[model samples]
Target: MQDLEIIASAGASFRPGDIPPPPDGGIEAWTQVAMGWIVIFATWGYVNSFGSFQAHYTSTLPQSPFQISWIGSIQVWFTFFGSAFSGRLLDAGFWIPTFLVGAGLQLIGIFMMSLSTSYWHLMITQGVVTGIGGGIIFAPSLALVATYFEKRRGIAIGLVTTGNSLGGTVYPLVVRALLPSIGMPWTARVLGFINLAGFILVAIFMRPRLPPRQTGPIIDWSAFRDTLYVSYVGGLFFFVWSVYYTFYYLASFGQQEVGMSFADSSLITTIINAVGLPTRVLIPVLADRIGPLNTIAPAALCVAIVAYTWVAVHDVAGVYIFSIFYGIASGAFQSLMPTGVASITTRLDTIGSKSHWGSYLGCAVEYTLRGAIGARESFEGWLEGKD
Candidate 1:
């Protein structure tokens, strides 16, 4: 009992030297990074392409923008919030089962989403079910990167995160073509198959190196008392809150305000993710060299400026320029948030715990503001910046 109390008390304050050495670079380690990349490609990629769906729903359905946004909102909420549950599972050494179930659920969710016709059906399957699976896959995919590449952790994480950018870039374009010709049901089914391919690789290659320490409480509330941890969490919450606003609404803004074709509007999203692909890789290399916080802090400031600047653009050229800057900046933010959390954590083993805390709370920040009551105001996006 006393030993347990001592561990609980020690919590996130433990020393870093206690951490086991990572493989740094070997065939197994690189394979894990590749697997993590595919994992995010299957999950976050879908989330990144939500704007394409949002535009279609707003134009086709009788549902109000407020109602439609909720679908995306719920999915986003669970994608991050569900991590609170799955991260603990990973920490307890249930890697194989947790990952398999997550991949399976994602397969089911996407297939179910294809059959959805009503608002509630889409919300339940695509928004809730898929998001939960995303959380399950996400926690372990991220944690393994930290485990395998102690010295190049940032670079490894950045590589995996680029999958989000790649999926975002590819999916919007793919769906845009399919939705116009093949239609929604087929479009979703095609995406499900893509996810299946990634899942196979994940089952084959993804792994964790160390056993769960189980060294302390599932959550170390005591870590909240640390000024650095607290400050980092606060900043991350606000930064995350500010992101995706651009991604979700940019397609609508292009078509509605600038009078672009649906194809052109969707292309705007493709541009952002395309620009992000290189940025995701390059910025994390910088993060490793200069430290994640120094890299993250400046990147956050750049994104905020880009977010508010959306109001001034009234032309395709201006929007294109905006996409270039926002993609690079936002990519840095997405890649760095988990990396940043991992940085201030006192012990390597506790990194997953710290990440879930920040991500769960950050989802709350976005969800509360994006709720139905203030829905239109929020989705107008950029706050006096769009719509």
Candidate 2:
């Protein structure tokens, strides 16, 4: 009890007026910023890298493509669902414990996945375990970044999101290179070790500037009543739906419609991530200068445009061009989402509302899954017409 008081006092010291102005080029400030990025990178990278695993699972398990996608979909579901539980835990000042729990689950999940020979094994290990772990890590990391930066929030979030882009680019290539040599089981174990190290660094260094008690409850349910807040959430749902649909299906579309080799289709995915990396950085910087919504609305419109263009383009070069433009637009939407949400709330204290995060993101993922299903059905219908 006494120890809790001491921790509470330390947290109280970080109140807006109490914190000293940041030092110019201060090592500590930069270090904190780096920690934020590292956490984001590790969590999102693991999440985005699902494609590599999904492809391998479908091929090895002899399941339909849709069944393989369920592995990722369930993973995404738990990632969002657990956010509500973890967010409140974070608000209570349990950041390190929360991160540690997430890291442990992720490691266990990876190991489980390494040993699995059945579909149910993959679902339990990857979908339930890793998804829950990702949720635990993601909520606190995002909340902590909010604690660290006020003026530079947009840019800071942008930098962190770039980690996801990097993971998307690198993870597929790594899996491709290793699958034939080390094989899936050993490869899973090796990547698990890498994730363990990254997450440990995050747990140790990713302390919130304002301690949990000072931040209030972890779950801020009242955020739902705000009209603008609802809009922000809705926008995020549509954005994620459109983006993930494109991410998961574009390669398959190219391979089937454009008659590209599997290797060429994979290159298109790389191109998307490559274009996304710079836009992730550039868009948020621009958002910080203009209003976040000012930047976001236009980008969302562009994504809609690109979605239709992707549907029309059946040639390799056209798909490549779509990948670049769509990737940039998607990156901009993602980089600005949290900033836009943060803007709608009057008190920053309520920003970590766990239920809202879960519902908003879960809805997005759900809609994305629906979009992918619909696109697949459409493609099959088109093929039937050609026959």
Candidate 3:
């Protein structure tokens, strides 16, 4: 928090030309980029698959939609909330401890989730345990990935961000495949093993290149006065709220309202993630040359357009069309966010505060939006009105 405030305060006074150059590319740097990518793949990949669980639970459990959503909401919210402290820890050079502990807890959480038979059980295991761990890992994956590249940072971070898209894209299919024969418990176990493998590699390769910034007052509160930071944070708050709410609930919406089979409904998630994969990578490359914010605004606008189109859809064809357009637009928004934040911040020490932690603060509001949407009675009536 103070880390970002101080940086935002400093960056507010500096000209863009004064920003220092990064190594841009080196063997070690790209290697670290790979490490960041893998951690994101495991951490976010797990969270991104929650739409599958959300849809499945709506049918199997007696829990209301609002109640079932708490598990996923908690899981995702912690990923944002925990990162504020984890970002500080990374700045303090505690990467190894943070990474390993997060991996262990995440694995345990995934395994524990497999045993869940009730709402509270899932809320504790998947929501609390795994969510906290995911947040811890998520901080560095965004923060550290930036330390290695500057000129092409948009694409580099974009590549790592694709972990969100790729994991979302692939894990749904993996869970769908495993659920029939192996069931949820064994299926979760398989994912746990994969998490162990991916994170082990991250543990070995992920290192903090910069020494800890221990001398400061921690976070400077005054950075909130910076207009750019304020605008950036405010914009993302509403943007992510809508994106997350839509993606998380989309499968169940397809199933119950659109008459998609469980398999077909689940496939909506797969398609959204799949369409985002290439867009995540390629769009950031565009952001690099054209500018991240310029790249982000148009894409963000398109997301708004497609989201409105979601209501008009009465069949799979309309859903697919919405998925394709929304996926590309939202993918650009996700991939460009770090780049956009970093572009304005002149200091490395505060970059995490400005980007990861700042966005986390913005994300808290999303839970409110999600909770509103989670209440199926009201949300369904709204959806019915759309028809």
| 258-373 per-residue lDDT for model 2 (tens digits) | 77765566666666776788988999888767667777888889888877776567688888898889888877777776666655555444445633462447555674655346
Model 3 scores a TM of 0.91
User: lDDT by residue for model 3 over 1-387, one digit each (tens)?
Assistant: 335434543553333464344567888778788888888888877787788888888889997656677788788788878776677677667788888888888999999989988888989999999988988878766787787676778889999988888888778898889998989999889989988988888888777666676754445444467677667777876676656766777787777777788777788888888788898899989877776767778888988887887768777788778878887888878888877777666567666555555456656876776566555564556555431
Select the stronger candidate by lDDT from 1 and 2: 1
Query: Residue 222 in model 2: shift from native, Å?
Result: 1.5
Measured against the true structure, the TM-scores of the candidates, in listed sequence, are: 0.91, 0.85, 0.91
Q: Give the TM-score of candidate 2.
A: 0.85
- Which candidate leads in lDDT? 1
Whole-model lDDT per candidate: 0.78, 0.68, 0.76
Lowest summed-lDDT stretch of 10 residues in model 1? 4-13
Off by over 4 Å in 1: 1-19, 372-382, 385-387
What overall lDDT, based on C-alpha atoms, would model 2 receive against the true structure? 0.68
Ranking by lDDT: 1, 3, 2
